[model samples]
Target: MSYWRWLWLALKMIYQLLCCSVSLILFCFNVFWLFCNLAIPWCTLTLLIVCIASKFVKLQRSPNEKRLLSLLSTPEDRPSYWAIANRAAGFDAPENSKAAIKKCLARGYRNVLLDAGLTSCGEIVLANPKRMNVAQQSLDELQKLNITEYHPMGSQYEPESMASLRQFAEFLDAEADQATVFLRLHDTSARMLDQLQKFMTTDEAFTQRTVVISRSPLAIYQLRKLKPEIICGLWHETFLSLAILKSSTLVTSIYGAILRNIIAPVIGISVVFLSKEEINLHIADLWRNVGVRPIVYMVNSPNEKRYFQKTMKIQYLTDSLRSEPHLLMKA
Candidate 1:
């Protein structure tokens, strides 16, 4: 072999090495830049939004046309709050059960937050319980409430049972004024999307109403690729421990809210499930950003719901109206 041939090979190897090194350095810098500039200051911004901005903007609502139950719901069909209720009147109804889901629909809730997640069998099912948290909760519910517990974490909790993904879809097909279902994904959306593709191809309304909300950015990203037409949301939140106490509610809500706001454009997230704190300021920031959607869960009271509607001027996720649902309109 010629010396020139060997030299040519050596140069090619050196060039390849140079390219790889540059790429690695660029990747590291990008990550560092995002962490320093975006992640850290977001909490501080939440404090500002909640403390400073919220004080000025008033929630100007009129006399009659305010409360949800009072609002002449049929024509509007799809309202803001999505009930996270169950069957057995949501008291003992299992999460994502046929009875519980049907009851929520029967009562005219157009949006529902159903716990649709992956189970041990690799099949999509309902019931959100930590294997760790389930046993204790089960014992408490069965003992105090005198009702059988549903959503027992593992078999040990009590013969663990969950509705299959297919059952959930079929039930939706049978329901009237079909709801916008929020599916909480525990794993990769890729697998679920594959399972859903058959339904999506044939059912138009099913595709339109379902929204996949996930904590995994990759899952949400993959979901978008599979069904771009379907609505999707990213569940984002990284919080400080002291952010909870109500004295700091203003600080935490605003701080977490701002961090969430900044995160939207960078990752192309529009709909989001923010942490349950910072109620007032979070809504305002998300509301002001015309394109971004803010959401929450488990609010079930007349006065509390009224406060959210009139003051925060935001929608929430609820479990049960509990009483005559229409009474909310009276005030």
Candidate 2:
């Protein structure tokens, strides 16, 4: 054969091979997608059934609680009202602000949960989830804004600027030596996690005292991958209205169940922070069975506080430490 003819044939053969390969890949992908569509509903239904059944089946505490408690240095006979400050006592001061954290420390609250996200300049700052533009602003811009105005009792408190995570760590170091900071991650980007990893690596004590929680399972999974020693928790709510899914209590509950039963274990989470409304003997027992500590949040009512502390025998997140006089007395 002529050289040009052979070259043309060779190019044609390569092109044909490429076309076939692409076709096979597309075919496999479609098959996989079809399988997922067929299987996911049945899987979800089965998980829902299991979740409902879990309510009736109560199990004793798994041996894993001892190890987790030891890691956290929590006492066996912890106070019934042992509460984590939600957004650093948000009711007293601007949520996720230095003032709020200071208020928490003053009220004898050592465990404070604050929202954290990365800024446009890549600095990690304490931010409110409601602020959609937080990630778009730099640290200086964020610090200039008066976050107190967004608070419910904004007019009552002085204007407060947004605080960075470094500032928070320094404040804790200087003021509350025994404080444990729970950072609920709002930014789940790789850069954010990398910066956090660096921060944790620099301060061994900070890493030891810090607990990272997130509503995103992927964030928790990635965080655990980055720093295996850091304690992580899955923040779950029974009903979160998502635009993608029809906002129904049942759908949300099933989604939460899938995360709790499947994703949480795979990610090696030590704790699960469930919303107060979802707290039940069966669900709490299910968590205990897997050695994961279950905590309820936004628990402010006296009756609810007593129920969780006395009846459930679990810790919780409370907005106002001042309102819980019984807790103050215990302190």
Candidate 3:
């Protein structure tokens, strides 16, 4: 056989191997999603499965696929918070449970947030082995910092009923001065948007003393139309600890979002909110700007918190950690 022919055959074999490896990886991810659904619904299942099977269909790559791949390969210096959340906390509610809250507080972070609906049976069983009202238990720890949890907007799949909101409202009404409510919006439809508007509008207290997470642009626009007292600007991406070291631009934007959307709404409007991450690579590096507080996370261990704080020079740290000084001991 000619030398050129042999080289061509070797290259073809390598290409086939690469393709097979990629296929196997996608297939395994599909199976893992199915397994996860055995416990909780993984909504992306159908889309993911279809994509996997369609690999055999050999359809020409659509523009959407090209765009998605481009986005995926955009060389994100910082990993997604969702990915880190899963890795650190097993995609379970334990990460947000009561013990986790206490641990996080002990780490010296004055402000924190939680997803109220994300609860763990372990927390219910262990924290209050007596099965105390877990909600109240959460409220107790939340009192320490400005905490907000979002109830998904659409179906009952992740829904917090109006009754739950009412209960939360009551909690806020009592501590209107000390604590503020952060409202999270889900992938909502037009009808859902209208209903949410009605709910917030009917109650002046709810509208005035609330921070919102508007997932969609329409949701943000609609909520503003209702003239809710405080509409948290959309935070499409949550700040992750890794992001601080990777891209200062990304971190600065997140800091600005928290200030404008999260902090300012809760504190007051006098606060000037700018795209901190977008403005420059570093707040100090670019201009002498103050009043910027950054959000950073610590997932694996308490010691990681100190490492992140020193490495990123983060002013704040969010973690599902217990208050143990030894936990944050030098990494």
Candidate 4:
């Protein structure tokens, strides 16, 4: 199954590259025709210089990157994991619920990844904004609703309420001493940052152990600017999804690579969550050379887990702990 999946992905990538090459040829021809017709030699020469200059322009390290480098010098600060429980082991309980987190901890997983979004009252909750209108409802109103109703295994577990980011932090402080939490932010608004800043200020441990990740480069940049010491991560996959929708996969892949390699470093991200399809030794090494940890997501196969863990020596996010019970024993 894995081999077939890889083959399919390779074929898709080849087709995309062919399409992109054709588009680039047409675009270049059109631009050349315009340049010849208008006869603007100076404008063309100036544009060429700017493009060439951009290649050699060195990017200065941000304050956050410097701080991250220092922190990474310590062996204890380096992230090592068997797997991160995606959505707090959602298969065991409702995703982003307190029950899911408790179950994940009980299963001996040390790394947990949760989605975060803001409520109507400016409170951060562990929920996906895209799935529901989390921003339109107050925290109180959201908590009253049964989060498990829409879940496939809702009847198997007791009714669960939406878990707040504060509650997750407090739970970590009390129950899980060695655990690390990764918060994937769905709402990257100023209000959400303010709340996160407040939490990080009050809890020193949380600030050190928690990694805040976002798909938006601007959001990550703003976060680093606001709190240079806080651990931040950039999430990739949105651009690839958009590329598929727009039928411009190769062009988008090039843009995504630039964003991941160039823009993410400039934003001072400490970690990067890449889609499973994007996992490759070259890209992983690229991130490692620059002091950024690369993690793959939605990995569920046990064989793939062993490859990523033993061979790649990288962490991954998995949806179900039940699928890999033996790995939990090693963790």
Candidate 5:
């Protein structure tokens, strides 16, 4: 099943890459939008915040990576699958809306994720604020991630309401007694991140309940400098690749030629949905050697959830927990 899905993802990515340029061009174009978005507001930030010095940040100091692989070595590593509600429980409501996220939490998913998009003005809104007269795929120049809901062909597009970062923070404070929220940073501006950081520091609950996932090296690095205790994961999306080759640490790992200690440290990763094919001990050992756990996405099927719960024994970042309501308590 994973093979077929990954194959389809490969084809879709190929189509997108050919239709749009994705390499460094993707990052460069986002920087262009960053400036445009920043310029939307009169001022960048309302408050002045001091950032910690880079030199003072704690670097990954474990002498060997084996010690950190402790999570992967034991059956007790995770008793219940630690699932992350991908995009706030998938089309249950518009992605990242309060309604959908609440549904996931009510269904017993303890972790939820949302894409954090910073607006041109100083506000941090959810990733997909609906735009007027916009063709969905073309919204991003490079079409990376392409997280959007498909409407009927020729259907008029209009956004009613989307959650703001502040609104999400408030919701998390209220709803997180039963769960945690993971914000995947989409915009890396210091001012934008400051909005998130300030909200996080409001009380002990904020920092304790919130986790961050980011692709930007500088941003995550800076996050470490600021809050060493926060759990941060490195997120990677390839509309393709096998587990051994496409991870964020691939270049540093050199196909396992180099020691994992030399690779950049990340607590976890977002990857394709794992199936029975991924249960090989040899393959698990290779990943264990690296010390990073896979946060599998696309666990929307009840059978798959049951399989993962019984066999995979790891974290799953899914969009269909509420859709498969019966699987929630049993799995």
Candidate 6:
């Protein structure tokens, strides 16, 4: 049978089991209450809790099953798959900021994207948190790597300041002709738009090669007007819920469709989902439907590393720690 068919059968079986079991329990309780033949004591509550816990145990995913799933639910590898790639490919900052980026460069990673945000601690120290450069040591490491493009990380879209906009424009101007700089806007503000417009019209870098991570349909419409080099879809955050999973024919379908149908083709854009587990069948199917690539994120474990490598079918694998000079030398 087709994959969809199997998915449908599985969903139906789960629904039936849930309904039948609940109905049987309710019927037994009602029958006993109606007869009033026995005294109900604390034992009854204890029994109910035990039965419910036992049911939950049966419903839990087994260890081997989880491992198998980790293997089978592989993500695709493609330029469009950067959402997952970024998390996997992130640098371990505390010990060495440049290590991960340098490793990516050595591994021939040309298209580089990063999550640029200030942590609570960073906010207290830096005046412009997002604009801070990599550590000198890290920058030195990056100097050794080949980088063609960089995308600024973001989620909200806020009005921009002319000064910040100019700073960004200048940063773009300083880069090579082939190099592109993309911004991820999280807040939707006219001031931000004004800044974007200034950068797009006046700045040679913005006019020639710049991209933005846009979420609002309205912002996308405005961005397309700029005639940017590329407009890709960006999923800033994803939180999974039971409602989303069961609502679909396949567990992955609901989310996949939102990104594909609702986010991509409409804007002539590509998309990135933040979490691997969150990129369910819904999102993958959506990618298949729209012919758009899907990406997953934030994978740090060794087991996850093996699973993504062997099963995720991801195009690019991003990981923390570019390289420990020691580890690389040892290798």
Top-TM-score structure, candidate number: 4
Q: Write the per-residue lDDT of candidate 5 for residues 1-331, one digit (tens) a residue.
A: 9999999999999998876665668889899898778854523242111112222433553323343233223233223335667777755655766666666656655567877776555666666434321212232331233223342211232333555666666777776555566778877778766776766667556666556777665676676555554556655444225654555565434533322222234322212123333334454455556555555566677676766566766566676565453555566
- Candidate 2 lDDT over 1-331, as tens digits, reads 6999999999999999999999999999999998899888888788778666655542322224554564455443433236788888887778877777766656555678889988899999888768647788899987888888998888877887777878878877886665677889978888988999889878877777778888877777776777777788888755454554445767656665666666666677788898886678988998878768888988988788778877898888988776674665666
Model 5: per-residue Cα lDDT at residue 263: 27
- TM-scores for all predictions: 0.57, 0.70, 0.36, 0.72, 0.57, 0.46
Off by over 4 Å in 6: 1-108, 114-182, 204-209, 215-217, 226-229, 242-259, 280-282, 302-306, 315-330
Number of the candidate with higher lDDT, 3 or 5: 5
Candidate 5 lDDT for residue 160: 31
Relative to the unseen true structure, what is the Cα RMSD of model 3? Answer: 19.0
lDDT of 6 by residue, 1-331 (tens): 6999999999999999999999999999989996564545555566557545544432111213333223223234312222122421433321112333343434433343433222222110111224344222232343343222121221122222212334434543554232333345554455455455655665544544444555564565455544433344455455445666657665555455454454455455544444676654554665756644455555555555456546765433345523322234447
Clashes of each: 6, 0, 6, 0, 2, 30
The whole-model lDDT of each prediction reads 0.53, 0.76, 0.38, 0.75, 0.54, 0.43
Candidate 4 on 203-310: residue-level lDDT in tens? 887887778888887887777676776788888764555546458766665565566556766677778888878768887887788767888988898888878877
Query: Which candidate, 2 or 3, has the higher TM-score?
Result: 2
Off by over 4 Å in 5: 1-82, 129-160, 239-260, 266-291, 322-331
Return the lDDT, model 1, position 304. Answer: 64
- How does candidate 2 score on lDDT? 0.76
Which stretches of model 1 miss by more than 4 angstroms? 1-89, 131-161, 189-203, 242-262, 323-325, 328-331
Model 3: per-residue lDDT, tens digit, 1-331? 6999999999999999999999999999999888886644554565456445544532221213333223222133322211112111212224333323232223332122323221222111112222224333443343343211221212222322222344555644653332223344432455545555676777777655454544354555455545534444343343334556356766556555444444333322211212223322364332223222333333344454454445543322233333223333433
Q: How many clashing pairs does model 1 include? A: 6
State which candidate, 1 or 4, has the greater lDDT: 4
- Candidate 2 displacement at residue 230 in angstroms: 1.0
**TM-score for candidate 6:** 0.46
Ranking of all candidate structures by their lDDT, best first: 2, 4, 5, 1, 6, 3
Ranking by TM-score: 4, 2, 1, 5, 6, 3
Candidate 3 global CA lDDT score: 0.38
